[model samples]
Target: MPISRSFRCSVFIGVSLDGFIARRDGDLHWLTSRGEAAGSDLGYEEFIAGIDAVVMGRGTYEPGRSYDPWPHEGRHCAVLSSTLPPDADPRVTVHRDLGTLLRELEERGTKSVYVDGGQVIRTFLREGLIDELTITTVPVLIGTGLPLFGPTGGDMPLVHLATRVFGAGVVQSSYAVDRTT
Candidate 1:
């Protein structure tokens, strides 16, 4: 069962109304505070179920490493980092280049990926490698923090696929990358 080379990279994340994924100290308190009303997950389970693997930046992986029990269990996870410490989690492999990482995953039969972390997502977007994005906008706005999108070289057009509003005042939108643009 060889993995197909036609890999689809997608992003599923939540950002504050002002566009910050995490607070100044890398805290996601504002986002997590509104925990899925009644374990709803706000469609995260559906999105993640379609992904074969997860890729994130070193900054994102480090924090999860400290969790009592790792968050992404039973999934092939890769961290993009050149300076990843030697004690990094055994469950994850470190890589320096995004292209090479995707190629390796594709060769392993990975068809879809969930691209995560602020820096990793921005880099993938800038490279025009992202295929789809499902961004959930949390109502509360944090004045300052890390933004989800930084300046890419040029404008990247996205085609709206769907939109949903949750009872928690959260708005989730899905978009397909307009590669032809």
Candidate 2:
């Protein structure tokens, strides 16, 4: 079944000033060196308030496993990986494809999905499945790393919804996919 417009897939991530989401090694310490801004959650609390579940790629999941509090405990989490063991984590559901995972979420009456990870976001954008994007740009620039976006097959037109400055020099921008194009 086709996904209802009511069910939205949104990407909320903090990227470097140079567009890198993380270092080649996936180290995010640069993102935490915000000085006085380090303590702030920025708009993460507010943005995640609308998310019903999280969908991420294995690369994201592997590193996220070390997060002290285990971020997606209460929310349903789906990890896209064909090689990840089924019992990798009790809190997560593993799936090999996005369509099947999304259909299951739709059937469960999910309204919002938070799409995380660099590759996963690109995949969603390539598939034209992402409805919105909320990107937070940190003040530092990492010369080389995993970029927030890579080349899709074609140009994607975005309609800017809003832009705001969060604690320090961080900038957050929201955009809606211009499906009319």
Candidate 3:
């Protein structure tokens, strides 16, 4: 049985038309290049504005933590990894147990969290914790790469919320996870 969640988990990410989130080597060059040329955040600020906390797995952390200007500044960030490097950003709280992490966040009154990384998203989704998902599809398809989602053992339905077109051909769709069958 799945446990109940008082806090909300949300995913805001970009994907290629082929359904991959990044290249096979974890490179986001294709995705970043397009966004930079388009000169749009594609509603990222608004989405982050609603997020009180941030959680991601080691794969996302390894790359995201290397940026010069750290993302998710001023928010409590948590990294889900049991094998994280000793020198990981000291600002982030590392957790080996997802359930405990979620429980603590809920107890702290965290209303919403921006859940990132492919594996982390799938884990949360499988646990029936994700409340919403916003996927921005770029025009280019890189053939094969890291997919945005994977099998979760069973079907999880979504309620369509809205879709918007960004600069050029970027299409962003928002969906509410339908918990009520």
Ranking by lDDT: 3, 2, 1
Q: Candidates' TM-scores?
A: 0.91, 0.91, 0.94
Model 2 whole-model lDDT (C-alpha atoms): 0.86
- Tens digits of per-residue lDDT for model 3 on 12-96? 9999999999998998989988777666899999999988999999899888777878887889888889898645678788888
lDDT string, candidate 2, 1-181, tens digits: 3345457899998889899988999888887666247457877889889889899999999988889899887899999888899798998999888778877788778899999999999988888889899888889878999998987778889999999887778888999999897
Candidate number that wins on lDDT, 1 or 2? 2
Please give the range of 10 consecutive residues that has the lowest summed lDDT in model 3: 85-94
Q: What is the C-alpha lDDT profile of model 1 across 1-181, one tens digit per residue? A: 2223577889999999999999989998788876464246889888888887899988898888878777778888889998996456798888877667877797778888899999999988887778899998888978999889998887888999999888678889999999676
RMSD of each: 3.4, 2.1, 1.5
lDDT, residue 111, model 2: 91
Considering TM-score, which of the candidate structures 1 and 3 is the better prediction for this target?
3
lDDT score at residue 146, model 3, on the 0-100 scale = 85
By summed lDDT, the worst window of 10 consecutive residues in model 1 runs over: 1-10
